[model samples]
Target: MLPAHRLPHLLSQAVDLQVSRCPYHFEPHPPSFSSQIRYSLLTDHLCPRSEFPSETVHILTAHSDEVWFLVFSHDGSRLASGAKDGEIILWDMKGESPKVQHKMRGQTDGIAHLAWSPDDSLLLSCGREDCPGAIVFNTQSGEVKCRVQNSAEDSLTCGAWSPDGQHFYVGGTRGQFLECALDGSVSSSWEGIRVNALAAHSSPRSVYAADTHCRIRRYNFQDMSYDNLIEEDHSIMSFTVSRSGRNALLNVANQGVHVWDLNDRCLVRRCHGVTQGHYTIHSCYGGLNDSFIASGSEDGNVYVWRSGKEKPALVLRGHSRTVNCVAWNPVYPTTLASASDDGTVRVWGKEKAALRQRQLAAASEPTGITGNGDVSESTSERRGELGGGGVGGLATSASSLASEQLDESLSAASLAEVGSDWQLAVDSLTSSMDSSVGVQPLSLPSLSSRPLPPPSDQLPADEEDEDQVTGSISTEV
Candidate 1:
């Protein structure tokens, strides 16, 4: 549920008004439940604006080499970004200035992926190619806690924390997926298979992992047994689970992003125009209950889409090289972190362009759930529930702590001197936006996002032989 203080302002927006008036037309799911109503109320506010983020505020250089992955800690107190030069920089998110807490580098392999433990204490860094091992680091002291290496020749590609936070699951290309203890000891295994990505769920007690062979399987988490499959014959690069843990956003090789129904094992939606052909371009669920999806593209731009829309609603263009990944701050709804092959990590939030739009909005209309001071019947009921300290209030209390963290984080003032092109990008975006437009990269030569199709004689690889799969950045398909 939205905070009682935030509700009135959220409901007054143009997008919210339109969605609320004709619920069936705007959202895919019916607003049959109170939570759904709250979702619609907050959707447009926290998401990356169609106004786009080009120059409002962001870090110009957070790494010396190309960045591969970035993830915010659970409590949102810290941000860790891994680079292609085998460097991991941990940033302090508290206060106005984001300080670099640690510039960690021990292993030789370039960083491929990173995951934070449930409590924000331990961070797992998975390496690339030659030495595809996993390293666990103590977040507080910036010390190496443990290292997990593959027993065989396959690269250790992915790792994820269990819901309980006691253990983590690790897998890789042509390697057996294993469940390991905190000390990097394998306790259980799912042998003889290859997994490109993994997302563990607690409610359904299952693990949803990519098959890399145009399929994603829902495995029985307990026994590590295969259960169901989401079938779509497209090469999958990576994935991010939805906030509800009921769905998945998959980065398919040539066909953009696909939302898979975890429960039903089918394609729910296809978010198009993600230029992901030559690499493992990662995408993430961000912006208030995963209401928005942001993806890195080969064309050096970040494509952001509202969860309900199939096309990109906001295009973040700033990186000189290909954007590799994006991570939304968990505590602050509007803040976003993006990594790129330009050898930098860019942070985005409310700044000049965003503030200007807000200022105009404030002058134009008084946004409130109770328009003209007459609250809707449902909204009135919600207000009463908040007073009673019921579900709505409890949810508010949980988020209020997160809001407190937001009050402490770096402001948009933390920015490098932006060139005039930044303002032009923002001004052009603010004046107009066509959600139907395809992904367009700025200041870059046009290249086909499509990959060269596979050979006619080369048959599709089975699950075991997926390492032979073609068309990937550094063999990460």
Candidate 2:
């Protein structure tokens, strides 16, 4: 039932070409009607970091039960998470700290994995209910953007957006994967064994689907048929391609992480003993410089590793149960968020070195530098201090004195040039900092000037509107 506009493009492949049997294969499961265990969103009652050993750093909790899947925005400003209890929470991860900004509910049955549009304005979530499947709403505006009934079929397991975001591919319980347009129409599908995971090829709008029987097949978006792709000896729990689309990381159940070089179509490297538990690696994503790999395990840990390293860069330990999904921060490469069966979501980062690199890279961006030259002075002074030579004692003393004078001169110049805007900003910032530091300072933002969005008082009336609004046509996918 693809939209009229897209049918021509989608059906062209089936016209003259010999229809090939779907090469993707998977293990068979006896048909049963029982539902999977549902998890709830985490509650705020237990602190997020309590499950971990650290204390100074606080955790941001939003769900009251298990989080089935979580993904960060393309720019990393926000996060979208779906729970087994049919709750969808959107978190603002930017600013000095992170907080849950919105919670959406519409799907009666628990939601499965979710895919964000490339530009991050809209989200598409699919699940099963009365029949086999239903796709419903959990968007930013709370609008039910679109809903689809799958001719009464089981729920879809995983899905991925095409690079252009105009279309998406979904894998279903019936051992088939289908491609459809955003307008709610199935364009094409390959009927096969149970399709567990699907990923959009990095270079083309084409897609790759992995079945339960350890087979991976590629399909060209231009035509809806399978292309010969690589396969594994065991079922692939997860797979991620590098930024350059040259290499891939594949996680097979109980087989650790496998590195496949797509260029050569051969296995290049493998890390042993990564999959200790029976749990599958739900998600595999590339990290900073495309040198690192980030994975969430059913064993309840988020592990970060490099290409050649036997040991992991960081092992994030927090979730009480298995970690089902994870997403890397696009803007902050070292940061990753994980959702667990224990109903908690944890944001993990590599050690100090990684954090330091991330911070430096962040600060180096033109947009990162803000408000006058106040912060620049501090950075410049530190660089100078670090670069200073180990000269004779008297010369070192003279140089040190000269550097101190230069610092004072720069500081004065910055203050003078900042003018009124700088003063007001500095005062507001200092006041906030003082409060956080346990020292009362100056006044806060004027209540009249900083009007908050309609509070909980206005939420009830807006609830319907918020839950059903879709992004503008101009909105980023």
Candidate 3:
């Protein structure tokens, strides 16, 4: 007879088999509905499977000071991070271990924001208030392409590249918003209340800017007129729009994270419990198809939340100081990178087979007798060995043992399929489901039969208006 503790695992496997056998039953339903069923079957059970590994796989200690900002290239080939010491490091992600490809010097006052051009040929770095200019660099040579100097009375705080890749926009503390050509010429200038954050959306051909008064304004590129999108009660520090342009994530000071539905023009969810003090911390959309939201916390940890969850799904502890930024790999959905005041960038990802082994080992502790006269003495001995150590020590041992199991199970592709299926379920829940469903269902797919759309076909073209040149200037650095 099978052990009572093994029933859940067997039942889960049986459900997976059923799902695989009649894949057509789910084909007729919307992806979101099918995903909801999958998520419920996988996570809502008494013994749940692990969604992702909660440990850091790689630690990158290349920067000397607090790391502030991280951004991946448009094609997701390289990742760039900025630090408090004004150094920008480019990481090559093709290898097993991330290697520094370029270490370029940025603003002296420290880098505040980074934006990559749509074509990925150029990078824009916005400096802190004390610095008078933003720097544009050539991605290949790491050479300074141009310097955009603000007037003595103005300082840049945020920036974004235009969809057409011809010009970029920069916002300053003095409420100055300017459109500049790649050759360092100011095309147009406008004034607003203090601009704190700027985001460009191509589909609407508009730019979204958050001001100090807790107001978000949309500037239409076609009409050159701007209007208020939404006004909040808290000060807006930073915000990022998802690649799909369906939702926007806002970081309100001391108010946690807010998700806004662009179509409905309403707040969908607010994820709390992430420590956000006076300092500015950035949040981003990542995971599979932007299904999860990740942010750095002042409490020296990275918090990840599913789009539908009101609280954090995972709290990753590795940084010794405040974490400042988190970026997800666009091409590879599983990989995540976080930068911190601890002066290191940590990379995280799911380890399927290893995580399963650890979970199975942890769940194997016998609570009752088996069909035999008594449980084996070896099982009792293993339990005693595990219980003999302190909690931290036991956790370490379990991780080590799981790593060993993973080394042996690496040949099996089923583990990889498990992660892939979960990712697909998440993508379907977030992207296909309408707002009427409230929060996305907390579930995952039982089968890995669904294929992901091609990267090119996944993103729609951003609708933007033609650049309207209003002014010009000459500068060199």
Candidate 4:
């Protein structure tokens, strides 16, 4: 039997194989989700990415210090951002152009994190204030709906919504995880080491919290009991669990991009050491389909990694200061928003224009490969024409093909009637009816079996091996 903790991870991986396709490569585009960039002479900027030079998207500067967090609505139509300035700003991404929709002020000590309801109608913001430190607001009208003060003495580091959207989980100054309802009533609480980062499974049945001691713990919402996950070498500053809930992407002080397999008892499969800068990951979000993971670091760079790949697909650098948080829109897989210590929030979309230019360049390059393997006499000239366009053109075509394949496979399967012989054949191969073996080959109960058996009965070891080999041969055929 599999360990209970590893069961979820295995099941999720099996489901993902049936429902989704992994990306061949992932890359981070320009940073567009933070505030204004300013260089302080106290320390030289240490940025750890080698992928791109510099590209700016939509830069919105309003805050003075660090813009701590960014989160999106369930539909991806709206966004909410929090910062050290103790203010929250909302953005409308569905508009023709991304624009700040509304701004709400609360929490005197500064906003540490923001959590949106599963439906996206209500948003919860937590910070350090004298009395009521936590507040909930309506995203549509910029209205303050409710506030909960003295719930926790310190700043709220992170918060998550329950799977059914009924309970909210908050972690911070209290050294515990509190379960509260929509009305702000505390339902249950689990106390532990001080938590710096937090995440919950998509089902919301379980919660994962990380502390300053470099330890991760899982808490069962039902019993309020917790289990200590394996401790790493560095403190778990920030982490993001995949949408499929099978694995997590974590950033340790010394280890970067730690992929923990939730199905395998949270086993650490691979660690892609991010030495881009000497800092920790502040914020991260997994892709909607769980294909990739994106993270914002104190090094002022955004890193993107394909779900199971060891190396990062792309690194985006533009923020002159450290980035505090990064969020990706659920509706648009390629669109990202971020906030930084420089007091800016920005939005970035894939550069279709730049891709087009690359395609045009490659199509005109010299001939390298064709029906014949040898390079032609005009190879150099042909390469010059094809090199530029080839890469971009290939990307566009591959994406199109992948989309079509996904649509075709995701549709539900249909059951239809078949011939009597086929029915008999299926029954002979699959039926569980008990009957004696017949003398006539055609009349034998084993030859023509409806539904397959439960696979409880075992054939001889040699026969079982033969059957396995034959099954593979038939599938190949």
Evaluated with TM-score, which candidate comes out highest? Answer: 3
Supply candidate 2's per-residue lDDT for 148: 51
Is candidate 2 or 4 superior in lDDT? 4
TM-scores, one per candidate: 0.65, 0.59, 0.67, 0.60
**Superposed model 4: Cα runs more than 4 Å off:** 1-55, 128-132, 151-155, 203-205, 266-280, 283-288, 353-477
By summed lDDT, the worst window of 10 consecutive residues in model 2 runs over 468-477
Displacement of residue 240 (Cα, Å) in model 4 is 1.8
Q: Give Cα-based local distance difference scores for all models.
A: 0.62, 0.55, 0.67, 0.56
lDDT of 1 by residue, 264-321 (tens): 8778889876777758888888765667778888887777776777756556666678
Best model number under lDDT: 3
Clash count for each candidate, listed in order shown: 1, 26, 5, 41
Q: What digit string (tens of lDDT, one per residue) describes model 3 on residues 266-344?
A: 8999987678967889999885567678888898878777666665655777677888888887777667888898888
The TM-score of candidate 2 is 0.59
Error of 2 at 37 (Å): 56
Whole-model lDDT, candidate 2? 0.55
Give the poorly placed runs of model 2, Cα more than 4 Å off: 1-58, 106-109, 128-131, 134-138, 202-205, 276-278, 350-477
